[model samples]
Target: MIAPLMKQAGRFSETTVDGEVVLLNLDDGAFFSLTGTAAEIWALIDGARNREAVIAELAARHNADHAAVAADLDPFLADLQARGFLAGA
Candidate 1:
């Protein structure tokens, strides 16, 4: 089973500023900003890419350690999930 986190429909709007992705939640008018690698991660969650696929891409793109990136990604994704910015995995 390849489960991926999908961005919630009609829940948020986004803008990019100086390389950061700023997401605004429509429900509560909450604004969340994702920068650097986090922005890249956000771009990958389009209902097509799985978590491992995202981790792989991020690792290759940054020449980063896979485990380390995964460690960071998990919590960030969880935060997004908690905020209702994501539909589910």
Candidate 2:
């Protein structure tokens, strides 16, 4: 089966400021901000790339190990999912 694509939640209003992604959740009236590598990861989840593809790109961009980046990526993505920042695919 094909890997699921990652996407931002529709309830969020997002903007990039100084290289960071700022997300406002209209449902909860809360603001979330992602910077540094987190911003990069957030930017990559555009409903087109799968998780592994994102990890690979991040690994190459940081010159880090694929396994290591994948390790780090899981929890960040999970947290985003838990917080309802990600849309179901």
Candidate 3:
């Protein structure tokens, strides 16, 4: 399965400023901004980490429970996929 944000890397222009991300969809001229935990998640999406890996790393970084992070993160990823910001498997 493709990492959710991998396939569409070419379709968006990503800019990071002060630990935040702004993604501009080239095809649609729509943009998305990421900050806080969202920015942290965006930084980990390197087209190599699977969903679990991403979650685990985030959990470790925050000394958080893996399941707890997943609870919030999975839905956010799904929303991004639905918005064409991510490529769902």
TM-score attained by model 1: 0.89
lDDT of each: 0.89, 0.83, 0.81
Arranged by TM-score, best first = 1, 2, 3
lDDT of 2 by residue, 12-36 (tens): 7889999989988878988999999
- Candidate 2 least-lDDT 10 residues: 1-10
Model 2 clash pairs? none
Q: Mark the regions of model 1 whose C-alpha exceeds 4 Å error after superposition.
A: none
Candidate 1 residue-wise lDDT, 1-89, digit = tens: 78877998888899999999999989999999998778888999989898899999989999999999899989998899888888874
Best-fitting candidate, measured by TM-score?
Answer: 1
Best of the two (1, 2) by TM-score = 1
Please write out the lDDT profile of model 3 over residues 1-89, one tens digit for every residue.
53434546677888998887998888899988999999888777777888888889999999999999999888988877766777762
